[model samples]
Target chain A: MPAIEVEGLTVRYGDLVAVDRLDLRAEAGRILALLGPNGAGKTSTVETLEGYRRRAGGKVAVLGLDPARDHAALTRRVGVMLQRGGVYPGMGPAEALSLWAAFYPRPLDPAGLLERVGLSAVTRTPWRRLSGGEQQRLSLALALVGRPEVVFLDEPTAGVDVKGRQVIRSVIAELRDEGVCVVLTTHQLEEVERLADRVVIVDRGRVVADGTPAELVTRGAGRSIRFGAPAGIDVAGLAARLGAPVNEVDPGEYEVGAAASPATVAALTAWLAERDLPLADLRAGRERLEDVFLRLTATGGAGDGGQR
Target chain B: MSSSPAASARQPGATPPSAARQLTRALAAQTAAEARLTLRRGESVLLTLAIPVGLLVFFSVVHVLPLPAGVRRPVQFLAPGILALAVMSTAMVSLGIATGFERQYLVLKRLGSTPLGRPTLLAAKTLAVLAVEVLQVAVLSGVALALGWRPGGDPAAALGAVLLATAAFSGIGLTMAGTLRAEVTLAAANGLYLILLLVGGMVFPLSHLPGALADVARALPSAALSGALHASLTGGGPGGGVESWAVLAGWAVLAPVVAAFTFRWE
Candidate 1:
């Protein structure tokens, strides 16, 4: 069975529906990235799945048990890095980890947990004394200390630097390798691209799109050919000669679309050769994931403005 | 892997006194952790211990209020009342105010999500308040003994009186903290502490007041606590003033039940 199954889930805060008819399933060893902008209910969805908040409608089964009904049991098997959770100011990182680990039936070694989160050196430092990155690492250590079967991380790399982000990414990968399901919510698209096995893009409290990264990228349409033209070459003539629509993006840059990327590149190169014009730069590729994301999310536009 | 038979049987309603003991131990651990956090906070320490001690010293030495006949030595009469006030200040005011803030911060919510249940969390917080009470009593008792105040009866009864008082006030405190906004709870708790210290007979004898305030004093939790303790310290029989005990019992039962019903975890 899947580790988490959320079917027709709806959560409302008063009149505002935070999560609307959401359907999702995650298996044992894959990372599912819940990507959304602020106020899109990503945090609310995760909180409901973790049994921290009650769902107003539909069903949520986590690890084969209802999260809201079987909270204590679910807590034993799942680890949560609560959004903006604060530890006691006076407690040292080691003491806090040890204390939290003691609450679980079977927990990872405190020392090893610290070391894995890169917090071993400052284990003795009090929580208030730790830097922002260190605190984030400590939070990660606490979430992993229970040796949980599934982990829910919300904005886990919010304040971390590049190195710290990589450390968290690697730890998440390691968790996946060990057959631990990870549900990560993040605004950083690059991190999602690198780490997520599947993507769930939420907008205005609904899942607008859900698939693999590459799959979502090509959902928009065909590829485009972008190149820098020679100064005096008839950029408009080249467009007419190649029988392809063209537009100058800048003084000497132009772009056009093609059904086949290789054919487009060859046609552009030969067209330049016939005209004895130097093609300063040329490339053809599918629509970028970011481009697809913007198009799908933006309110005012449709499909790259018809290749212009 | 399956759980041990004993562990499986220990589920909610089954066998094993050991399971109950383990639950109690878990509760105690949670309580200790909370107390440790409270003690580490400088402001909480000041509010819990320092403010009461300061108030006690200030009211005992100052002769601002009038005294009655046969109540010679205002210090002696004020001493028991101040002791009760200390309990109220820590167990009721400080505890209530802190819990309100904790609820606002979602600290209590995090704790509630643990293997520990809501009832266990309340029990643990009450137990932690008791631990702080013991320390408060030791300090106040030491200070009182040094100040030439002598107990007229068995010391054990006095200790029992203080413990009962702590329980009664803690219940009221937790209830208010759980139900009210942090800002409102803070103001109400501190305001009530001052009102009780003066009019509820914590620093002044209720007998010294005229009809109206005296009647109100008799019903206040601080009055029951201070009067009961005063009666015990002065060798008075517990039989005549079962009213105080009854008042305390009413609060101890009602406040916790109400708190449990109304408490908001987030």
Candidate 2:
């Protein structure tokens, strides 16, 4: 069995169906990124798995235990890091960690975990008095103090500073290395690409895409050559010379798709030089996870999938 | 989904201290945290300890109450009433307001997600409330003794009466805090405190009011507590009667049961 599983999961809020027939599975020793646009039932589904919400229909399990039924048993082995407002405003980081450290069967040392999350400097600062990044770090530290087998992080790096993000990423990487199942929801595609072993994209409460990050990038959210050049260039002329499709993605920025071949790059450079148009910038055969995410969840691109 | 591996094979990691401490430690540590927080808040301290002390000192000195003809000293009457008020301040007002804000700030929700769970959390909170009440009783009793109020009733009975009142008030407070918004709870709790302070027969004689109003006030939880405390501590006052214990016991049982069913952890 996978570390976490959900099949035909349906969640509703009175008359509104929030999560509809959602399905997901995650395994140990890997990181799965759950991504979606706002109001797409991501929070609902995650909260149900965290046992904070009642599922309207379907099966959901973590560590082979039903989250809603065996919640007390499940919470002991699962670490859930909420996005905000978990600590007392008057309590400092060390104090809060120590307080929660008593909740599990075996917990990491509060002082050591604080330092691991780079919170040693602010161990004595009140939670409310800490900066946004410090608060995020403290939240992450609290989640790991339980020494859980599986961890759920909700936007762990949403507002974190660069240094804080680095600390969080490293700590998460360490968790994965220790064979912990790490499931997280984030809007940061770059973070997903850098850290996630698998990406699950949901749109309108349904899983639109699920695969390894590389598989996702190549799953018809295909390879492209994107560069900056003068506005209103002869995109059609370039497409014909390169035997590909070209478009000005934005003013003065262009994209050449259809494999972004080396021969295409050569022809494109040659064509640009023939017109004395400077090749301002060029990147070849690189596909971004953001493109896949956007294409899968675009507001107007619904049902179109936008695959090549 | 991978059927290839064990359901969840525990892997190697840092060895941390054993957790889910025995229930005794959970209760002790959580009670300490709760008591520390309740005492640490300047406003809660003022409301719980200082306000009752100030009221006892103020009313004993002011001579504003219409003391019935046979009463010997003002402190004799005011001490028990103020002590009852102290219970209300701590259990109903201070605790209720704090929990309201905790729920609002998602503190309760976060704690519920842990293994401490809801029942243990409530138990810890109750134990903390008992600890604070111990201080309230000792301080109020010392001040009363200094003011020449000679006690003639059972100290054990007085303590029992206070415990009964504590349970009733805590239940009512939790019900309010759990169901209402934090801001709404704040407004309503303070408003209830002020009303109970007057109608509880604390500083004045209930009999001095119109017959029907006095009878209604006598049935209020504040009145029941004051009457029970008076019967146990200072012998008997206008509000004191055997029926007071029955009324307080009724609420002691009913309120917590209601709260147990209605309270929302989140």
Candidate 3:
């Protein structure tokens, strides 16, 4: 069975439906990245899976057991790293980690986990005294100490520094290598590209797109060639010769929306030569994940456009 | 990389210990950590330990209030009352306020999501409160003994009363902590502590109050605890009336049950 599964999941807060009929599955030895704009039900879905919030409808199973009814048994097999407020303000990292480790049947050594997270030198520092990056690193360490079969991380690198982010990435990779199912939600598209094996994008409490990074980038708005030339070129004439839609996105910047085959390149070169329009620069590119994300999520606001 | 046994032991498939063993260890660790934190806070120390000892010594040495018909010494009337107050402050006021803030900061919510069950967490907290009460009893008894105070009643009865008082107060405290906001719990706990001190016959005898108020005071858990302690400590043979035990027992059973049902983790 898949390590984690959800079917027809629905979550509502009074009159507001935070997550509506969502389905997700993650197998062992894989990373499933949940990406979405703010207020798109990413947190609500993850929280339901973790058994922190009650489900309004449908089924959610982790390790083949109901998360809510079998919470104690499920907790032993799964780990969760929240967005904030898990550690005591005045407690040191060693104390907090060791306290959490006691709850597990067999746990990683608190000291060793701290060193692995690059927090050995500051283990004695109180949680409130640690920097934001250090706190994030410690939180990650606590989540891993349980040696869980499945782990859910929300915004794992939100405030982490470059070195801290690298450590987290390596740790996540190691967990995946060990056949531990991992599900993470993050806004860093670059991190998603580097770490995710499967991507599920949510918008307005529904899955808008779900695929691998390569598949998502190549699926819609296929291969294109962009060039910089003089403004006001013959757009209608170029369309007839190339048999593709050409758009002048900006002044002097033109895009040809079609595969750049040898014949197409040669034809375009001849056409430009005939007009004596000097092509300053030209490169073939595919649609970026960020571009797709923005196009799918943008309604009117820049970033705050989603059901909350 | 596999040269060291420690490295091999750190592998992912290391077999877990029994669940019972893990729960036991978690409870011990949580209790110790809670006790250590309570001891470290200067304000909590003042409320739980210092104030009770201070009252015991000051009342034993001075004659500030008029003596009742049978009471010859002020300490005879004050020691048991102070002991009851100690339990109320530690188990009710201090525990409730601390737990309320812990919930507010999401500490309880985080722990609740872990392998440690809610019942285990509550057990750990109760154990921590008892550990601190041990220290409070020792210091208060020592002060009272130094001032020539002697127990004239059954030691077993006194022990039972203290335990019952602890349970009754802790139940109410956890109820407040679980149901109310942190700031609101803080204010309400302090307010109840003061009110009980005045009317529950902790610093003064219930007889000093007017007729109706005196009857009400006698029915409260605080007054019940004080009356039981006084009877056992002063050779009065469980001086508390039947209504006092019934009141204390009722609170001990009802408050925790209500809290378990109504408590919010976050």
Candidate 4:
């Protein structure tokens, strides 16, 4: 059964529609990445799912409870790491964990949880004394304190450095392995590509694309191919010779799409061999999720008269 | 949603902590945490304990007011008034300023997101304030006694007066803190404290005020609280009776309700 289900969700801040009609579902033990740009209502959607905001219109269920109606119950079952939260100045990181533990029925031991977030060494350091990355790690611990079945992480690694980012990804991955439904929202394309099992792309308050990473990139977003032609060879002539639709996205950089991968590679290699063209640098691969997001969002914005 | 041992404790046939016990334990833990933080912060500690002591000593030693004929020394009259000010200062100013900063820091929002509901949070805060106020009253009473001041009325009534004053001022303080910005709350709390101290008979008798200001002072919670304290402590002067109690009670009840409605978690 799905851990979360939202049907026709609409949320607005004043006259600005933050989340246009949207639908999404995340099954238990799966990582669903809600990807969107800033101001794309990612926070609003996450907040709504966390029962932090009231939806203008929608039918929503989190852990089989209506978020708007059973907010306290849902909150207990679902853990959330908000983008920014209040930290008391006097409470050390360890003390904060202890206090939060008191609120839950059964919580992770403070030491173990601290170690999990890499905050064990600074357990006694006040929150204000921690570095930015350390504070983010502490916030992650708080989200996991309740041993919640579903965790909602909103930009969990926004300001984190490379190592910290990897730690966050590992933590999310571990949570999923533990049978917790992880709804990860981030603008980091690489993080989504690395961690998400399913991708939900939202733009301007609507879901523009949703599928597995490979499926979305392969199906609609075009692929890229780069190869070296003879020094005197014409790039456009190479495109015609290869018998495939191609475009020079940049000087010396070309992108192409074909129905069959092996056939396309063979055709390109054969064409090069026939011309005694040494393929100095050859590159071919499926389209990236970033390209898919940018193209879909860019196309929509352009179609809507560029207001976006 | 996983059920553990605690879940079994909440099952239909299992025993649960009584409501009173739960409230007590929660209130105790909350109060202790708040109090520890309140004490560790130098600024709040000064505001809570030092300010009251300083005002008491300055007014008692500086001879700020001339005593009426046949009345005891100025310290006798000023001591009870200072006690009322202490309660007002701690409950209203200290609570207001602290809560404002707490709100600004999103501490209240974070707490609310937990199982610690608003009522428990309020109870905890009130208890913390009261604990400080209790120490304030005890220390002030001891100092005043050393200065040869003695209450000339019913002992229980004087204690009752102190308790009432604390309750009333705390309500007003929490209300103002919950409703205003930290900067605005700090300013308003200090400004209101001074206004009440001067006009509401903390430093001198309301009888000494001009007719119009004295009338306003009579309605002020600080004045009512001071008046009640004075009537009990000095056992001489215009007795506050039920009217003063009512004024203080009005503030105590009304402030918190308004605060609850207006407070922002963040």
Candidate 5:
């Protein structure tokens, strides 16, 4: 059975429907990244799964128990790192981690967890005095201290510096390798690309696209050829010759889609040579995750049913 | 790092600790942390400990208020009242305001999502309040004794009064903390503390007040606490007035129920 299952889940704040009917699942030993813009209901959906917010309608289960009804039992198996404000401002990171560790039956050693999160240097510094990146790392440590079977992290690397981000990335990778189920929400597309095994993109209270990163980029928008050329080039001439949709995205950068084949490439080179239009650079690749996300979310309603 | 028990504990077939053991450890850890936080805050110390002790000393040395007909000295008369005031401040005002800010900061929201259940969290907070009150009582009693105050009542009766007052005040405090904004709770708690300090018959006798206000004071939990403590400490009997005990008992039951129903973590 999956570690977490949400079917037809809906959450509303009075007249405002924060999360519309949504279905999601995560199995043990995999990392599922929930990506969305601000106010797209990513927090509402995650909070519902964590049992912090009540669901207006539908089912949400963590480790086979209803999150809302079985919160006391479910919390033991799942750990959560909220976006902000969990640690006491005056308490040092060491103290905070030790206290949180004690909440679990077989918790990680506080000192070791602190060192693992790269917070050993600031172990004695009060939470209020720590930098934002340090605070995020400490929060992550608190979540991992519980030896949770499943973990949910919201914006885990929001303000983290490069080194701190690496520490968090490695820790999350370790959690996945240990056969633990990991679910996280982040706006950092690069982080998602690096860490997430599966990506679920939610927009305006609904899941717009859900699949592996490669599947999303490849399927959402097919392969394209991008190159830089002189502005105001006769893109109509190129389109007539190539017999495919081509547009100049910027003043100098142009993109050719649906005609990225070798024959099209040769034809385009021949066409450019015939017209003496210099191709400053040329690259052929599938769409990046960022491009796919922007297109899917910017279009509002589920554009393509890439659900898996 | 791989040899760490935390790593081994995650392996399949490893036995998870029993639920009862987890609960017990969580409760203890939370209580200790809560107490440490309360003690570390300068404002909490000033309000809960300093102000009460200062009042006890000042009132004991200076005969500022007129005493009742049979009271021999002001120290003897004011000691028990100050004790009640200390209980009110620590359990109600201090706990209420601190909890309000904790909620505002989402500290409670975070902890509420953990394996430590709400009931257990409440129990840990109550335990922390009691722990602070223990120190408050010890320091205040020592000061009172230094100023020539003697207790004439059953020790058990005074102990019972302290426990009841803690319950009544903590319940009311938690109700305020759980329902209102941090700033609002701060203002409301301090306002109630001051009102009770003067009209609840802590420094002044309720008999000295006009008939209508005195009756109102008699019904309040603060006055009930002071009256019960007075009867136990000075009157040398378990009869701190059945009515006062009844009022306190009613508050002790009702306030917690109301708080539990209305409390929000964030």
Candidate 6:
């Protein structure tokens, strides 16, 4: 059995349907990154699998135990790192870590874990006083303290500095080597590319794509041109002129996730030149995960563009 | 698939202690941590310790308020009411408002995910409240003693009244914190403190009010607790021991049950 499995999961808050029949599976010894735009129901899906949410309908099992029905048993094996502010403001990381460690039968050493997370210097610093990077590291430390088989991290590197990112990345890579199942949700595609073994993109409460990072990168494998321009550019007009689908993957960032021959590049540049638009960063390569992501979920999604 | 080779090698859940043992260990550890957190906070110390003592000392010496009929010393009547106020402050005003903010700040929400489940968390918070209540009672009684106020009546009953009143006020506090927004709970807790002090007869005598209002005031959780404590300490008076204990017990049970049903994690 997969370490984490959700079959036809459905979650609703009052009248609004947050998650609708979503299914996912993550294997042991690998990191699966769940990605989505804001309000795309990623939190609802992750929280339901963690047993914090009561699903409207569907079956979710972590380690073969029903998350909602067998929550108490599941919690023993599952560790959750909330998106923000779980530690008490008044408590220092040292005291807090030791207290949380007492919950598990045999937890990792709090002091060693602190050092591993690069938090030895600020052991006595209260949670509120710690920088955002330090706090995220502490949260990661707490999540790992239990030595849990399955760990759910919400935006582990959202506001982290480069050193903090390196620390988190190394710890996560180590978890996979130890055969732990790591599930995370984040917006940083670079982190996903560097850390995630499998990538699952969720949009409108469903999985739009699920595969290994390499598989996803090459799934739509082809020569493509990516560039940065002012946001709200007429993607439809550009696609018609260049005969390649153009999407604003992020605000003011565009991706052309398709065949981009010499003609297409000249056409794109000419189109910009006619409007006196200075082309920002430009790249010609195989479809990256970001291009695939934007292709799968753009301003409208699949079947939402002009040519190619 | 079974767990990873490395994970399975650690003898996961193999030699763990019994469930009861783990829970007991968690409870003790959490309580100690909570106590430290509670005491270190300036606001917590001020609410749970300083203000109650300040009210008791100020009222006993100032002699500004009129005494109830048949009451000889100001400390005799004011001591019981002020003690009840202390419990209310710790249970509802101090702890309850903090818990409401805890919900907003993700303290309670994050803790909920751990093996130290909601019941254990609630128990830890309650024990912390009781610890503060114990300190408040000791300091208040000491102040009352030095004020030349003779405390007579049922010592055992006074202790019982304190415990029951703590339960009742904590139930009220949790109810507000779990359901309402933190800011609203903060405002409401302080507002309720003042309301109870005036109307619950903790400061003013119940008899001073109109008959219907006095009857209602006597039945509130605050009034019931103070009345029961006063009756116990004074050896017998209009504080009305037996019925007040029953009223407090009722609140102690009903309010928490309601809170258990209504509370939202975040």
Better of 5 and 6 by DockQ: 5
How badly does each model clash, as a count of residue pairs?
Answer: 0, 2, 0, 1, 0, 1
Q: Could you say which candidate leads in lDDT?
A: 5
DockQ of 5: 0.53
| Model 5 global lDDT (CA atoms, 0 to 1) | 0.86
Residues A1-308 of candidate 5: C-alpha lDDT, one tens digit per residue = 99989998899999999898999999899999999889989999999988888999988889999888888888777889989878888889999998988887777788888877888899989899999889999888888887888999999988878988998898898888888899999989999999899999998888888888888877743368887888999999888988887899999888887646788889888988998999898866667888888887785346453454
TM-score of chain B of each: 0.82, 0.90, 0.92, 0.86, 0.92, 0.90
Worst 10 residues of 1 chain A by lDDT: A299-308
Model 4 DockQ class: acceptable
By the lDDT metric, which is better: model 3 or model 6? Answer: 6
- Tens digit of per-residue lDDT, candidate 2, span A1-308: 89999999999999899999999999998999999999988999999999999999999989999999999988788898898888888889988998887776566778777877888888989888999999999988888877788899999998889999998998888888778899999999999999999988888888888988888876663377888889999899889888889999999999887666667777888898899997778866545788777778888766744231
Candidate 5 lDDT over residue span B1-266, tens digit each:
35544466455554766878878888999999999999998988999889988888887778788776678788888888898999999899989998998898888988877778888988999999999889988998899998999988766887887888888888889899998999999999999999988877788788888999888888899998888998888874222588888988888888888988898878
Each prediction's whole-model lDDT (CA): 0.75, 0.85, 0.83, 0.76, 0.86, 0.85
Error of 1 at A283 (Å): 5.9
Chain B, candidate 2: TM-score: 0.90
> Tens digits of per-residue lDDT for model 6 on A232-280?
8899999888777888989888988666577777888999999888888
Best by DockQ: 5
TM-score of model 4 (first chain only): 0.90
Q: Tens digits of per-residue lDDT for model 1 on B1-266? A: 11322123223343324546656656767788778877877877887778767766665577775544455655566667777877787788878888888777556666555555677777877778878878877887777666666767656866766677677777677778878898999899888887887776666567777889788878877888777777777666222177876776676677667767777777
RMSD of each: 5.8, 4.2, 3.9, 4.5, 2.7, 5.7
Model 5 / residue B165 / CA error / Å = 1.5
Write out the backbone clash pairs for model 4: B92-B173
lDDT of 6: 0.85
TM-score of each: 0.86, 0.92, 0.89, 0.88, 0.93, 0.87
Better of 1 and 2 by DockQ: 2
The two-chain DockQ for each candidate, comma-separated, is 0.21, 0.39, 0.43, 0.29, 0.53, 0.37
Query: lDDT tens digits, residues A148-216, model 4?
Result: 889988888989988888778878887776678999888899988889999998888888788889887
Q: List the residue pairs that clash in candidate 3.
A: none
